[model samples]
Target: MIVENKEFHSRICVDALENAKSVFSPLSSEEKQLLLEQMIAHEFKKGEVIYRVGEKPDGVLYLVHGKAKIAKAGIGGREQIVRMAGVHSFIGYRALFAEEESYASATTLEETFLVQLPFETVVSVIRSNSDFALALLKSFATDLRFAENRTVTLTQKHIRGRLAESLLLLHKEYGVGDDEQTLQVLLSREDVAKFSNMTPSNAIRTLSAFAQEGVIALEGRAIKILNIDELERISRLG
Candidate 1:
């Protein structure tokens, strides 16, 4: 959506600016406002590529709204989705900080809104603020830890264990419904498969197995947990 002349400093812009601080903390009040002055929100359509692998890094991008998936194409042209991001998530910082090409492709899994920070200002902020530099280090370190856990899940776990863990992660990321059962975000079988490191056929089969075993209840895109305790047991056992 285009910014209206009357609402240039709209609440959304102010909110996004505050959030920018969480990602780039070295920004002083004056500096943040200055960077905010340069920011313009961009909307993305569903299934659009925000950036592709091997492209030179330019700016830091944050999801102001919606979801994105980072994926890589493997041997035989199979695409493996590595991560899913939601509103307020940090992305594209690795390549920007490293001053290299992006290692993975980022695409909109749903319609998205983003706030892009100019590269020149990013470098300046990092240089001027020690706390901001530490914030970046902690942020990247947290991401690395999550990535490491995901690697173990994909490489070591059995199919059932992986799916159970994937569902738990999704629930943790989104939340359980008021019933304390259904996953908050609806997903296609293929997307679920990608997150669980399985094929679509395997995802479907395992979901069915879970349903029959009273591990979960599935109705179309909605999944409700029948026995979260058992699910946790499976995740732990894996």
Candidate 2:
């Protein structure tokens, strides 16, 4: 859930800016301040749609806190998750740069906070700053590489491999909780299936199999890694 404290919101927004050092570092102090002034903070509840396919990109959305799932629907209304993004990243920017409608949808995986910078302001700043433009280009390249890798994984991997890789990916993204074993982000079976590109029933069965094999433990929505080596081996085997 989003904290209601305005002070906390402002603090995290600053933190998010700090975390994005590569992007903001290129700007002059005055330019940074000007861009910060134009930012507007927004909070979204779990499962809320941040943006949808066919929507015109109005601004670049910076995720300040919590997680979001980016996905595209396929035939028969199935969802194929493109990726999950957390704090200290920008969303909806590719569409904004392309001057086209969003090609995919972004939804809040949990209560999330974001700061939106106007598209016009972003364009203006990029036009004025070569460093910032180069940084954005690098970000786009990174995402494109990730998309290419995911395409290979989904097409070549078996169900066991796919789910194992997904688990490893989630751990890489959200990390572990204070227990250092339980996953920080709690995803429902359906969400996991969508992210893994499998049917919900198959996802559930595979998760149960993992538990039975002593690779993981499930307690409600929490998943604890019991055998990291084994899980990684399964992921790599595919």
Candidate 3:
């Protein structure tokens, strides 16, 4: 269930922290309590902006539920999706540790629940805990690597390859429905284009092409992969 109040938020936070079994696992009970005390839960509807470019980092925002996309506005107000954050993910943190304004904006892809860890408390915990600091550093490095790879993909991959890769990425992030074919997440064509670095018209045309070729089956906002092998091949070739 979605966390609605501070008490429930605290419980969910504890559960997420425990399940992380990384940084939070090593935290002492007192430390955990301290973090829980500092945390504040906020809910957002689909398409709501959580944070925007040039906004100063207030705290570390954790995705307690639902999904969000991190993107940066490019020429002509076109948005280039940097990454998609799923449940149990952290968003808008790169700017927090860097001590700078956010370079990207985070927006909810669906109704989302967020837990904000006050920046002061985060700094204090990291100062007191070397393990947590190290974990966060590792996470930052991993994100940098992903950004580097995405740069290569978006710049070099063909349109078909880019769209194929995006579908695969969405599948990995959100999984599939009960039928094990249709994707779990529902996204507008515009959002899909932003993720794939294409215009909405192009995205629509290519998706139609894929559908005609039987590479995928499209039903409104739903996309079902009918030929995973071919999709992977297209991604590989590009």
Candidate 4:
């Protein structure tokens, strides 16, 4: 559900840009203001595809609220979840910088808000602001490292370890709910399977097994970690 683009001065749009200050912290006040003035804000409903694979990016997207997943379509139309983006995260910039079509799609996990800095503006900043360019390079490096680590984990880890690590990864990204136990992000079993690199049925059975082992408690889509230490141990052993 994409909303009509809003002016930067609109309250919601302003708030969204406020949440993304860290990304522009390297810019001077005037440059930051100019960038924000040129940004366009968009809202997407849960399950909406933000961008599809092979689409050309027009701008760099900054996730201001809610969650999103970056995924690539696999065999039989299955999607492999490559990365999860939360508030203050950037998406679509890699393709923009590389001048290539998006290799993966981005979808909203919940009602999401984002601000897009135009491609020309971003390129201008990168050329003029040395610190900003370096910061983006560092961010790229960090993402590469995480992808390399996840590739190893998904390929080599057993089912139990994979599931456990996926849950931990969710916790790290979204933190706990009000009870400080239930995961804040609610995902379907299939989404979990994609993220963990397993079949949906296998993910279900392993989740049930973990519940039986007193490592986690499940209520609908909410997964509560009952024993963090045990969960970590299983992930480590694999």
Clashes of each: 0, 0, 0, 0
lDDT of 3 by residue, 165-228 (tens): 9999898888898898899889899999999999899999999999999999999999999888
Model 1 lDDT per residue over 113-169, tens place: 777778788667777888877877787798899899999889999999999998888
Model 1 compared with the native: what TM-score? 0.88
TM-score of 4: 0.93
Better of 1 and 2 by TM-score: 2
Off by over 4 Å in 1: 1-10, 19-21, 24-27
With candidate 2 superimposed using the best TM-score fit, by how many Å does residue 126's alpha carbon deviate from the native? 2.3
Alpha-carbon shift of residue 68 in model 4 (angstroms): 0.7
All candidates: CA RMSD (Å)? 2.5, 2.3, 2.3, 2.0
lDDT of each: 0.81, 0.86, 0.86, 0.86
Model 2 misplaced stretches (Cα beyond 4 Å): 1-9, 20-22
- Global local distance difference test of model 3: 0.86
For model 4, residues 1-238, the per-residue Cα lDDT tens digits are: 3345444335555565454445666777777777867877788889999999999997888888889999999899888999998887789888888999999999999998887878898889889999988977887787889899999999999999999999999988899978889998999999999999999999999999999999999999989998999999999987
lDDT of 2 by residue, 86-163 (tens): 766778888888889999999998988888888889789889999888987787787789889989998899999999
